[model samples]
Target: MEDNFSNALLLMGVGLTTVFAVLFLIIGFGNLLIKAVNKYAPEEEKPKLQAADNKAVASIDPAVEQAIDLAVQQLTGGKGRAVKIQRL
Candidate 1:
């Protein structure tokens, strides 16, 4: 009975140690791969959107702006107000 108990404890210890060792190795390898990729494969620059000089920028209405401000204040229980209103 004593021998059986000792064997079971040894097996359990070995299994837990193996599991932790595998997790540690996986994390180490993942970090190494990430560093390699970041060093060799830097991000490319994306093109910025350009608007023509002649294109007219849309203006926001004062009445709509006031309404938005009022709604935001009410939504926040009179604690907040919209700082800027822009027409999409």
Candidate 2:
């Protein structure tokens, strides 16, 4: 009976230790990967022509716009409004 109790305690300690070790490794490796990527390949700004083109608005069908507005109002309990909608 004493041996069984000791064996159970040993297994529990080993299991908890293994779980914590794996978690620490995952967190450390993920942070290291993010840092390496950001250092080597930082974001670049869009070209001036593309940036200017983005400011121009295209025409939208009135019926489609109304449907989108109604959907947003119903979904958000009349609190949220659609700022932009794009087709995927």
Best by TM-score: 1
Count of backbone clashes, every candidate in sequence = 0, 0
Per-model CA lDDT versus the true structure: 0.70, 0.69
Candidate whose lDDT is highest: 1
Number of colliding residue pairs in model 2: 0
Give one digit per residue, the lDDT tens place, for model 2 in 1-86. 99999999999999999999999999999999899989997654422222222333134555775677668879998766665655
Question: For candidate 1, lDDT tens digit of each residue in 1-88?
Answer: 9999999999999999999999999999999999998999765442222223323213545577577777987999876767655444
The candidate 1 region of ten consecutive residues with least summed lDDT is: 48-57
Q: Would you estimate the TM-scores of all the predictions?
A: 0.49, 0.49
- Worst lDDT 10-window in candidate 2: 46-55
Candidate 1 clash pair list? none
